[model samples]
Target chain A: MKKINFYILLFVALLSVLGAGCINEQTEDVASNGESGENEVTGTETQIDTIYQFSVIDALLEGVYDGEITCGELKENGDFGLGTFDNLDGEMLELDGVIYQVKADGNVYEVQDTETSPFAAVTFFETDIQDSIKTEMNSQELAAFIEDMLPSQNLMYAVKVTGNFSYMKTRSVAAQEKPYPRLVDVTKDQSVFEFNDTEGTIVGYWMPEFVNGINVPGYHLHFITTDRTAGGHILDYTISSGTIEIDSCDSFYLELPENENYQSTGLSADNEADLEEAEN
Target chain B: MKKINFYILLFVALLSVLGAGCINEQTEDVASNGESGENEVTGTETQIDTIYQFSVIDALLEGVYDGEITCGELKENGDFGLGTFDNLDGEMLELDGVIYQVKADGNVYEVQDTETSPFAAVTFFETDIQDSIKTEMNSQELAAFIEDMLPSQNLMYAVKVTGNFSYMKTRSVAAQEKPYPRLVDVTKDQSVFEFNDTEGTIVGYWMPEFVNGINVPGYHLHFITTDRTAGGHILDYTISSGTIEIDSCDSFYLELPENENYQSTGLSADNEADLEEAEN
Candidate 1:
């Protein structure tokens, strides 16, 4: 009887083992496939929309701490590195003194120096170079606009010049955003400029909040400002710099450009070409 | 030779079966432990936080939204039903228009009526209380101090809020730290206020940005607007009626009280105290 009972237990255990064994084998195969599935091939879902920031000088000098990292960090990771023109499925352009590689996917980064890094060999695309010059702005217009846009409350503004720049990994740092407002006299004498040493007249208009915000007054606006200051940065090729500050309570609506393509001045989107990327 | 070969194959197969069988037994033991581990007398490291939104009227009249499910969809499941005050761990406070059960652990959910559903049995923590009070221009003293503390350009700011009300969940949608400027205006209307007739004082404050942003306001400043209005919510009454629009922004400045205890002016820290117990 003892032997019979022992054999019954043994047989039951053996059958359970066999059943579990086969199930385990099948489950192991499923688990292995599921674990490695993530790395097999980059899923179409892996392709995500990402934005990068690039600093002109940082790319050329092969240095870190550029605008590219600042902008990229604002969105997600701050890992925008320099790229070469050769491997890019896009084009390249030279603005001011810096070289930029613009990718077909709308990614713009600093072009690496070919001589320094073997992998940095790049192709510069200069297929389209139009002399993007706008009609000049009269002295009355520039002066009137500057006089009108003075801030009432105490305010501070910043201009990002060529240098080492860094931004928080995200727009909010520990639940705080928006640039600081410092007490400044916007109407200060140094804030305004009439013209440089050039024979041609020059006028400067400053929007402290506009540039300090995310988007820079891109090239089109730059051209308008430069043209308004006729022969200033445009004719003499000198980077004209200036700002006007106000320290008192003043309510004035500065004249923003009504030009269709100008984004900074709050352009209208009714026009066909203007309808493409009009800023709200 | 054939008999010997058959014996060898059988022995190897038995060994393989034994090894797989042992592994399967061990795996089953581990899987079973998962449930026991959670309910163990000795607490496990596992902890989860969830947030829910309900109006003051809903909280007082019907009790907290009792609709809940244990394993799947709560809404689809049926009447998971109303919540009621189980017991009080510490102090009680008045907000909106009713008396709320304030737990020592800082959990401040509405005390419901039925005991059938989980929501009916559990206590809700007051993580945040929404109101409409203008903060920026209300007090010159507070406004100037906040303005002075604005961080410099490219520098990150760390602002926090801690007080009576919800702590587990915040208006934390999309992780943008800065509250929307328009929301501030929307909540600024005088019509949004209902003077607590008993105390004869108004309650509400301007809502700041929910999350961080490129150019956003700080969370502490929002606290100044929201938590300090009408000299604060009643220290002993439950929320009677609240008409405030809150997104995920409630999470803003949530972790603040965890690190530092703020001198919460409104309704006392009873709500905040109830909500933070599980976190510690």
Candidate 2:
């Protein structure tokens, strides 16, 4: 009976030691994770390439539509991208390191680096894949063709299509004053412009579906003429011939606005329907 | 005629000099911005706090249900957040510096730091605001109340609700095998659990609408008991009394999966409807 008791005591002591060891290890893990600054300072730089986003779609939908980031700062992030100026001033197209504003009057203006945007997504263009289109294709057909050629559906792609278009249809909205209306409302008064046999480039992103609320899903393209005289948000286009360059992005970064209007807006409403209406 | 010609020449020279000056400034700006690594290295460490996200809802909806980040890495980013394991194994609730897996067997297991998750949103808990709720409220009412009390809708908020609840309803999905079904389909087989007059804490986030596609808009809460034995994704709750702590985030970083499955998934569908169905 004494031997049995001693054996039981030994088992209990072993269990306690193991339990304590587990607890100690967990405590150390938590302590290390919680020490943010020290670890980051000591750790090697993260070499991840990331796509930078300014503001968010929900704030735009709720009428918090004033620019927070300047064109100068935006350019610091990427050389190619699309967005609108403050108060939905006009469609912005950044191509070949130059920023152009396509106004509702159907004329393009060279935007100063000092100008600001309420929303934008930009990336330094580095071509991962390049291909040429031999056959004529419209916007829908072009999207379909690209869809078939995509290496993967899960990754975000930045696409640049440069060529002469048989016909191009685009639209631009006038800038609004303070107390801006929602993006959908602002887009309602957009002016449509058409070009015949225009040589230009389309700058846009093929966003993954998972980024729906945060960004426009699928192909979002903007156009600018080669001469930098005309451009707008691309609605439709007939590509006579073109070369497509795609950049696959594996990292993403989002910067939110700090203004009071952005902070106070009611953002709980389901805005997908509205977003589709405005974007399409 | 000679005098006039000389004046024109002088004017042209002046114009050329000014143009050269502008071009030089722009060239410098582009050069500085294009060199990402050198600029980041030289620039002061950005003191801005940020929330990090992995994968996205749309990817999961399209059946891209595989773990890409280990629990060890996730904890390295933040100690407080919620997500699911590989193949929708169980509900993941990381609270108070410990990661817990509430399995379908209705048991809480301390997840190893080495386990991986397909999706997650985590931010170190550093409370910016703390307030006590004096009134009784249901889940909807509590959400509404919290909305009214928020400092800003544009900023992301990590919220913690701790107190005794009149009732708490939660759900957890069983672990899935390879060739997983859509999230909606997987959710159809979820197991729901309820607790009466229980004391526990809710860990979750209040995301802006602009991030709809990237994350769940509004409140997303996961629960764990005080004893750390019972918990899951919070479906509803009646809070008798609780203290709410919120941490406002101004920056966000999203880490994409490096796996091939994440690389090849088609993410072009409008997934707001599907996301709403899966989340709510």
Candidate 3:
């Protein structure tokens, strides 16, 4: 009986040590993951949904036009997007996993993998809603119509309109040297191009008012023709008929530049008025 | 010689197996942590800075006053902050790791640990800048002064002011029942209080315009006396003397509720005007 009791006590001590070790391991795992341990025990993988952004509109407004990411790196994040190349070289349009630069000379050049962008918004195109419009409408009317069609005003939307346009007016800014002026100043000298009965796709995003400083608050579209010959930032377009595709983006991930220019730039001035002036 | 060669080959094979095992272990560690192997090699621990928010202000404005998190859970995130209790019970003041409820009954109660908040912003208090204010100034002047004192407009700031107030005016919303009206409507019946020669601390945050819909655009402050007696959402104050502390926050993390009320709410309306009307 004495031997049995002693053995039982020894077993209990060993069990307690093992239990404490398990608890310690569990605690460390929870602390490292910053989450409860239930998921770990079940081996559940947490899905992180994110909408990747290259740069902010505020930095662009502050005249930090230097590109920090190459076109090759940008393609890894999204196949469809819009922005300008380094030093405002041209209006950038990405569609079908290909990037095109519409220069001020009214010509579309396939962007080289080595090329870079100052500011851009891109995403793997996935449509949640699709509709066709047969009525003729201009840019402003189409913007209003899209706003009306949106399921929720609080969420951001990626927009794609593809079809033939009766009239398309677009503009592209010339590349600038160092000491770039504010976007509003550079945009004043933009070269405009007018195309008649053009077949192309319009790619852009509709941002909410809350993200105004971070991104354009309304429709920001860029046009790229089917023949890959001519395109630019869409200023005004009369769509004869088109199919509209909308993707409601619930996740947002903004990547800020790590360059010295972005670090030293002064972004305090309220750029709302300036942004509106430049965008229009 | 033949035996030596066999032994040498066996040793090399063993070393290769060990090296491959180490590599496999390292790969698994990196995959589990969801970080690159390069960061692991540098032995640098990434500090994830987050601003744990309660429910959104839009839901509050829309009259969704249900509390999703308890003060105890909130205390786990930060010790300094301000907000309102469930059903707009009263003003919530969190200071020095304790939460106080200043209700319409004109009494301050140390809130029970189970008490919850509908909306609040809190951070572990860490001051980056400290200064004294000698000049007497009203609420607007103090706001401007603090704005001028901020090191950067792009970053968020946690502010704390402690001293004597020549005059302070505050308001607290009464607890509401179900079928709650909009915040603008509830503000019409708020209980306002005025104090003279009060000594206390003011706590709040200065948010950027980019977070307009996510949070209050500017300052959102609440006051609590040093004696743990009286406080509410600060409407106006005439500061006689005070010491100000500001913490510049470079990282922001927002946590949204997963409740049915939040999931189905209509938040697209331009609530800026309504927010301004209700806040002032």
**Winning candidate number (DockQ):** 2
Error of 3 at A127 (Å): 3.4
lDDT of 2 by residue, B1-280 (tens): 0001223334443443455554334323322221121211111112114677898767777777689898877765666789889888889997755789999888999987788899898766666778888889999988988777787777888888899999999989898877778888988888899999999899999987667656777888999999988999988889999898777778787888866566656564577678877776
* DockQ of predicted candidate 3: 0.09
- Model 1: residue A224 alpha-carbon error in angstroms: 22
Candidate 2: lDDT over CA atoms?
Answer: 0.74
Q: Model 3, B95: alpha-carbon shift in Å?
A: 5.5
Candidate with maximal TM-score: 2
lDDT (0-100) at residue A119 of candidate 3?
85
TM-score, A chain, model 2? 0.81
Taken over the whole model, the C-alpha lDDT of each candidate is 0.21, 0.74, 0.72
DockQ of 1: 0.03
Cα lDDT of model 2 by residue, A153-213, tens digit: 6667888888989999999999898777888998899999999999988999997766766
Model 2 RMSD vs true structure: 17.7
Q: Is candidate 1 or candidate 3 better by TM-score?
A: 3
lDDT of 3 at A215: 81
